[model samples]
Target: MGALHLMPGTTFSNAEELGDYDPKRHASLTLRELERYIALEVVGSCHQSIHSGLGRPPIAVWREDEGEIPLRLPQDRMRFWLTFLPEEERTLRPDGIHLFGLRYWSPALSADVGRSKRRLLVKYDPRDMSRVFVRRPSGNFVEARYADVTLPSVTLREAQTARRTLLEKGRREVDMRSIIRTAMAQRELVEVAAKKTAAARHAKARGSKSKVDDGGWGSLRGVDSSKPVPFVEDAN
Candidate 1:
């Protein structure tokens, strides 16, 4: 199949008047906007215009033609489209699924355990790596959503980076299970540290409050520890 280049003409050309053209100037339009303008206006005009070579309007000739045109898409077009999708190979673990820094698990993947092959194919969209599709031997794609294991504050990029950094040490081949286990352990440690930091801040705040009260009481120089203290009456 040959490709046809469709371009929009801004104005009618006159060879006698070269002043109509300016070499330094070009159309100030984005590619998308230009394509839209051409499709909506220029192409429509051309379709209705009588073609000098064909002796008929392009649309009329196209409609009146009796020969068959290839309009149907191929059955394997989906597979071909999927060929461009980024592939992430992962093995299902007993605990759950983990890939691209975020942990993921589903009942379908859980059932895929003990398969004849240990490795499973995972196809993901680069635009949104939060979910992936797992392919089975039967050529069926199973949708696997992202696991909710990461903290709400953690972004998708951060999650993917965290796993990438974990897996990228010393160029040694790493097992999926071990990588996930280590990552989970590290995550737990981080959680514990975060909790400890929060608790420490709370304790410090409480201590400061106590200290302020103590300072207020201690600032009184003439307080008699042995004497019975009388409560101050409100002057209501």
Candidate 2:
């Protein structure tokens, strides 16, 4: 499992502004619930904007624009589309200047069954600023609009990136262990071959010495037979 920390001050926009709302009254919803709501809302909106023949409408008012609207405080938990604008382009337009599509406010904790973690996932199209997707655990999906007013202190991207990094690190660790095991097996094979060679050499030396002793005994028996034959003739 992985975790991400959402910092405050992340902002997003949508086709229409969501009216004012309070989070204190609805404290009954758990943190996971809130996260799910944001994810579903953002992803749905992005998909609609891109694929629903909407001609890529402007989702949110850019922050840098002169007439950009300020998001109301104590926001409602409504879904909205988000996009990133290059610094150069941000200064050009007010309402229709977002670069990457799909943005959403995420909570601190949520269940991500896909990755087995409570993390947020954001998918956006840089080419089409209208198509964006956000995923969370709430089971609530919002498309092409702002979520019900909810103060979001975290950005979805940060959470997703952190989770990815942790998973990659874990994989590297597993690979290292496998390499060590393979090296150890190779070393054991070398030791076994050396022991077998030493035993064969010792056996060959012993066999040679036994053959020499047998040959010496045979020579001695032949020489003694000559003396035995002379004693037999004298008796006859």
Candidate 3:
């Protein structure tokens, strides 16, 4: 047994040392060639030729115990894989389950009027948003179809990205509105100040004009033209 182990182990390790072990060359091999090489030249030869301590060829022993291997159907495998997908807690809204702005509903969900606003675990595929699976109270996943099928296809990734982009745009619009309001308020203040300054200047000009008009009367205060009786002549 030790002699047999030494030979096979040395052969496998030496295969990598050979020039045929180039990864690029190996990758270029077709699937048929690869499979044939693996099945015939690799462990397949060992399984068929080598005998274990049980005194039977490794492949024969494996064949005898084939029933011990678990056989899973395609649907069962899918179910098993889906069970591990990440789930989100969502509520059933009036329109249906809203995920990334898209609504999803099913006949089962629509039939239950009392389920509105109820929380459920939802699992969806990023590659396909046309349908989602909701974990029902019975601990089973129920398929939910998109409410509007006429629309373009939307993946979960696209939905999330669009939602984020819209959110950012909304926030930007809010900030712009705030800035516009502040600018408007500042403009109003400036306009009010300008009006007040203009009014003050006008009032001052009016007062100065009135004083100038009254000064003309002051020049006539000493003049008494009605009692003038003598003529005055210039004497050198």
Per-residue lDDT over 126-209 for candidate 3, one digit per residue giving the tens place of the 0 to 100 score: 666778887765567778877765544555555555555556667533322233334345546756876776677558757774
lDDT of 1 at 52: 98
Candidate 1, residue 229: how far the Cα is off, in Å: 88
Predicted model with the maximum TM-score? 3
Give candidate 3 regions above 4 Å deviation. 1-78, 115-118, 171-236
Off by over 4 Å in 1: 1-68, 76-80, 149-236
| lDDT value, candidate 1, whole model | 0.56
Query: How high is the lDDT of residue 222 in model 2?
Result: 26
> Which scores higher on TM-score, 1 or 3?
3
**Is candidate 2 or 3 superior in lDDT?**
3
lDDT per residue as tens, model 2, 1-236: 01111111111142232123222321233346657655644544443344345455234223234366655644443333333422122111212112222122323222332333333344453333233344435644323211222222222333233334445667533322232233345445645765675567457647775632332221222234445432111131
List clashing residue pairs in candidate 3.
Answer: none
lDDT-superior candidate, 1 or 3: 3
User: Which candidate number maximizes lDDT?
Assistant: 3
Q: How close is candidate 1 to the true structure, as a TM-score?
A: 0.38
